[model samples]
Target: MREIQTKSTSRVTAQATDIVLRQTDSIRLIFRPTIIDNVKNKEAALKGIFLYQKKSKKAAWEDFETIPLSSVKGGEGYKLEIKTAELLQLFQELTQLYELHQKEGVPRGQKRYVQATPQLEQLASLSDSDIHSFSNANVAVGTSLLSKLLVWATSLDDPSPLIERLVEINPDSLSKLNAALGMQSLKNALASWEENECISDEEFWQESLTKHSFVLEQVFSWPTSIVKGKAYVGGKNVFNQDGNIVDFLLRNRLTQSAALVEIKTPMAPLLGAKYRQTYNVSTELSGSIMQVLNYKHSLQEDFQSLTGRSGDLFDSLNPQCAVIVGNAGSELDDPAKKKAFELYRHQFPGLTVVTFDELFDKTRQLISLLESEPRVEVESDDMPF
Candidate 1:
């Protein structure tokens, strides 16, 4: 008997082992029993007999034929048998058929099977020893590479590379990442204010808004198209003879009209003591409103002088005014008090009154929306500011 050794490779849980091909007048294939027990029926597991041929030592292995496995059997482990002469005849027929197709060109809608290169075949049929060796080496190499990458990332001053990589991997994550960064920045700003105890200082409040004007823009619902003008512009001889300075002066980009802003500490009162069984606006809030209105009046009175020097930047005829003052405390908790406050606010046409708490709360809600629904389009009417 001539023995033909064939490579055995496992593609499933059960492994085919000790595969040997013995040739007499007929060829017999024998293999050891598989270890798989999950299969309900062992006979059904045998599908077909596959034949592979290696044309030369340098050539890749190719499938020769697939025949029904039920035709031949050996009771011991598992076996198949086929006539040697018939196999040779089958090979000759296939070779002729392939040559004929090559000359005529393959018909449309039919694909000709192509064998993989030798290198790819070797990788697909890696030995058990090779698999264990690769697994062991991969663990050590992979761990070392990951550790080095972590160290490099932590040592870098800029995070753009890492952020870019994340965005490249998944573009949908960009908005969520941006929102997280924004939240961290806001936290840092709040922490700084707490540490420095500057929240109560009017000058510090103005400077903070000046440095990060986006916060002010969001609070006021100002469109990005508008331009923020000078801060603390002294009306001196131009707008007022008293030399009063305005906290912030803003102008519309398209109209070139100006607006006045007055900021107060959050600790200021929102409502004052009852007078004649009716709640009145706190002295702090009323004073800020009057101040902003005075600035507007002064600018309108001296519009000619101011326009000549500042290139007609102010719309003195209908300048808008806004006051950022105290938090909405217990006063707004009562329904009657809330109604009274709204009624008072509606009396002023050109002036807007916004509480510090309202602004901060709106900011928080905006951040939450960004985190939860990053891709959602926000409408202008949906914004509280």
Candidate 2:
């Protein structure tokens, strides 16, 4: 290492060490720190920059081309210029050298950047092929990988090329990726449904809907009318100080028109004892529909006041109400029962009633539509594990 001295306007002198970060057959790169005192002038103080090859390999390595300091301290306004492939390699090597130094130079008191630092390091150790194998792994493992990636991505500076790749990923590619992920999520929801089919706990269903709000989006047959909304707007759908909570307070993302959702356990009956020629709607189902309607009316009456207080724009104009209850697959297996249930639900103006099974079945049909293209078959024996 060689020392370079520079004198400031105040006659204060600071020394910087010339450290060779990388060297090849015909090129060399050195990190020469000039000064570090940011009190007077940050630009002049931050003049420490990279020095590239400017002299013969055998000669004293004094002469070199200076790389802009902004390249190392990356930002949106900064541009890194690497003319030749050799210089690019040197830059990469220099970055790796600095990364190793950073790894060894952890500051006192700050234990780690993230909670799962060791897991992140282990995840970083995975090869391309090893990471590819994660496609077949469990959800927990996949979530872990995503968590680690999020930590790493957030740690990087803004305008990072790695994150910018998302821009190059066209809309069609994103749609396909989204469809694949949606298919997986729907499948998971189905499995969860099967597991909790016998469960009558209302909280379980509520929590499930909260965890997967996309499932509620499937409730809307007209997808174009509404965009996604938070599962629990105003935190648990509390629109007023009265502590009145709705299961979900959905809104048309474009129109801001509100919708109230009321949920009941899957075990809730869809129909009751036969009366006259048709079976009557179950007390539970009817009660839920009424509950959602009441919430809708309350929301409509308080819309302007709530909007003024919260400063959130929403319309309660002819608000829609929906009730999700019972397993239609089992209860509506009878043609007469199914028809009665459908007719009863349709009678209510501005109200929609959907069974738990029917809601997920809509999701299943959507996934089928997304994957309707002709598939190329690969023999099991030829398939790569």
Candidate 3:
């Protein structure tokens, strides 16, 4: 299932080259710079981090290797609840890595207990020894390392309480044996955003839509309040017979054709060079509008075949748009790109568009506006199909 909260935009063009250029930040930062700087030696820290990661990943390999139905009998409900709980806990911790600090675990100021999300607490598969170690631990990654975590965690709203506990663990527990023994803190090793002495880094580089989506799944998959639906349907590999699905078909009613996202690193521009040229608001103006024209075309074809609707709602009517999301006072300044994007928008009316700031503003007030009313009523009993 997917979450309901999000921002939307229209589609654009791309190909194999686009795919190559489209590497998510998650894949780019092997180990956070902050973590590396504090680890004594870069190579050694990376090795340690990888080892920890590999340890936690055994669950995936084990689950994949084992065929559930054959291995377990009865208590399927309990078994499912157990596994889902584990995955959710893991996902929450992984997500905290993309927040403002970019490290892992919880940040300063917030309550530590929030880390114990329902899934984390419900995970009973953990071994007794591992549980003991987890309970009595104090994580001591360096300040730089914590800074990186802040960057990553900023991407998420609030991590689970267990994650907060992991971040506070001691360094000794991160060793090979300790990590393999179910060191949940290892997930934080995914990133270490260096809070370089440059205020520019914090000022300019804003998170993009793609980056937002990437962190969402990592941070929270099974929501606290479940959204009943058939499945999630975007980020590639999502298609339905009609642009429409049954009312309950989607876990999150807030689905879109495709969205374009851009990543900004506060001071990426001040560093000059390629970073300066690519990050300007004007430069990114077009980035949001044209994220997935190719995907839109593909969906159009599929939707047509499935629904056989009268008009070209599937083909000619591709309502994909762009969203220039990120921090405030961190907008694009380039003029040419802005002009081109403006021209494109004037030409396309159906395409929804906005910046991350704009999206945030709307989201905050939207809840009240929506609550004031309700979903549009459907008087006709007949289904569109």
Angstrom error of the Cα, residue 193, model 2: value is 2.2
Candidate 2, which ten residues in sequence have the lowest lDDT sum?
106-115
**Global lDDT of each candidate:** 0.59, 0.67, 0.34
For candidate 1, write residues 101-167 as lDDT tens digits: 3443222222233345686568559886895687588988656755776797998766665777776
Candidate 1's error at 29, in angstroms?
89
List TM-score per model, in order: 0.46, 0.57, 0.24
Q: Top model by lDDT, which number?
A: 2
Error of 3 at 255 (Å): 12
**lDDT per residue (tens digit) for residues 254-325 in model 2:** 667777788898899999999888898889988888777777767666666667765455577787778889
> The CA-based lDDT of model 2 is what?
0.67
TM-score winner: 2
lDDT of 2 at 367: 67
What candidate 2 gets wrong by more than 4 Å, as runs, is 1-162, 165-176, 224-243, 309-312, 374-385
TM-score of 2: 0.57
